[model samples]
Target: MSMQLNRQLPMPADLKAQHPLSPAVLERKAQRDREIREVFEGKSDKFIVIIGPCSADNQEALLEYVHRLAEINEAVKDRLLLIPRVYTNKPRTTGQGYKGMLHQPSPDKAPDLLEGIIAIRRMHIRVIEGTGLTAADEMLYPENRSYLDDVLSYEAVGARSVENQQHRLTASGMDIPVGMKNPTSGDLSVMLNSIQAAQSSHNFLYRGWDATTGGNPLAHAILRGGVDKYGTCVPNYHYEDLMRLLELYGERDLLNPAVIVDVNHSNSDKKYKEQIRITSEVLHSRSHSRELHKLVKGVMIESYLEEGCQPIEGERTYGKSITDPCLGWADTRSLIFSIAERA
Candidate 1:
């Protein structure tokens, strides 16, 4: 006997049909994007700090957190260019778990994707307006770009997607500075290829229209450690490794040769407390080696209102990460201050 299949289907309506950006928002985003590009080009020496929740599950909590960050920005205005990571979506390795607030705001509930998109956009806009600080986010889905392209200042292609042709093509057309992270296996070559692809002109299909890209000159690299079965961080951001990578890029003649060191991830072996040590060590190495120092542009840290992380299955904890363990506020503050002093 043949069995019938039961499958749920997505609605045909466009996600942005309900909510669209006003011209004012687009202008604001354009100005912010220019400033970000300036910083990436070394025209502005401000140390870019992209900080926020590991996954923004609650809009209210994220808004409150950015308000505090804005205050910190005022205090460190001379030294840092603050960009809150209002990351609404996440990519899983084996494609399991909660994904992010966009997929499942409530752990036990079915995905309200339409509502999720609106919630994320609202939260992002609020952060930009409320804190008066620029925002950064990972571009996970190309289709979702239209909804957010007007509000974000900086864009990132995460480790899992850096080598993807679709992501590289998308980055090529982005007006904002794009940071391409090294692969999860700690391969710098993949990042270099991704960066090169993003910095070159390309023609691809986009939105039912033929599109040609002007190419992004502000595309760069991000060094986040690698994970293996034994659980050790490889390709540690040491002076030699960084120097070699930079030299390779120079040889390849890539437009942007700078890199951002991700202080959390494998670099810290996922130990939130160790992020401080790793950051200090990298800075010290850079200080002694002029070559590496020139190649090192900034740093990225995973931080939130609270420290560490809690599982989504049990009772949820406040301000903690649902995906990865992040450095708590206290540790984050101390690290930022220390790094600023070093700068």
Candidate 2:
């Protein structure tokens, strides 16, 4: 074999025990989970904002960012539900570069999976305990979900992973809301099929044993736009796009027929500053039609302390993203208030 086995890492159980969440944190997470679920289940009319850094590289900077969000949450709590993105596992298109805090606790340091696991859990715990807000993370590696399952209130299946069988099966089992993004190829059918799989019961191989899941009714759609055959960014967050998605959902017998428009990614063509305009446009689209207003749950924005991203190899700026560029604090706060007013 060409690959050498690295030292065995602790299982999720061991890691959980080592860096356990206090009862207060657990309680807060439970409450936040229920509230977020209510939004997807149509029990609540409040819109959700899954906003934060694209990749949480530094715990200090991330916590600082979340703290700021906490203040904004207070201002928008009546109209919006803020679920900050503590996305630790980033999906790399080329399977290289900074993979997030789950691979390297420190961006400049080497990869240490064991330490990375502990660090991520601890950071999550601190976020809940300090801010009383649970977070959202990307379920990049299906098997790794259990490590943070107890603390995470929301999970997203990236556009790249939405078509994977394991991702679909794992999403089916989650108790929290799992947002399934349109695949990079821009196929709505494929995305809906994945949502169907996730919203149905499944018995499959997970970890080292056979596991059965009773399905997740909170599974829903997230449109992050897509790449065309010739590499152009094709956006699908317009009024027409929402109508099309609503029509598609009408054909399916799925449970929580809702969608969250991701304003960044291909929707903005990775132009970070365009997030503000794209988000406003989605809200404008929602306001024009009652069907769209009901179908569109909320929007996702990648925002951090600083406005843009920096190279990972150099001396990085604190709070600036090392992965995807994100909206800075000032703009993010203003946008949240604007969304709350419109919502």
lDDT of each candidate versus the true structure: 0.79, 0.93
Q: Estimate each model's TM-score.
A: 0.90, 0.99
Candidate with the greatest TM-score versus the true structure? 2
Clash count list over all predictions: 1, 0
Q: 1-343 in candidate 1: lDDT tens per residue?
A: 5975545322323444455556666676677677767777778766677777777876777788889888877778787777888888898888888777677665568877766766777777777777777688888887677777767888889989998998999899988888999988888889999999999999998766689998999899998878776766785577777777877887787885788888777787777777777778888887887767667877788888788888877777777787788888887777778777886
Q: Lowest-lDDT window of 10 residues in candidate 1?
A: 8-17
Q: Give the lDDT of residue 101 in candidate 2.
A: 88
Give candidates' CA RMSD values in order: 3.1, 0.8
Model 2 scores worst on lDDT over the 10 consecutive residues at 21-30
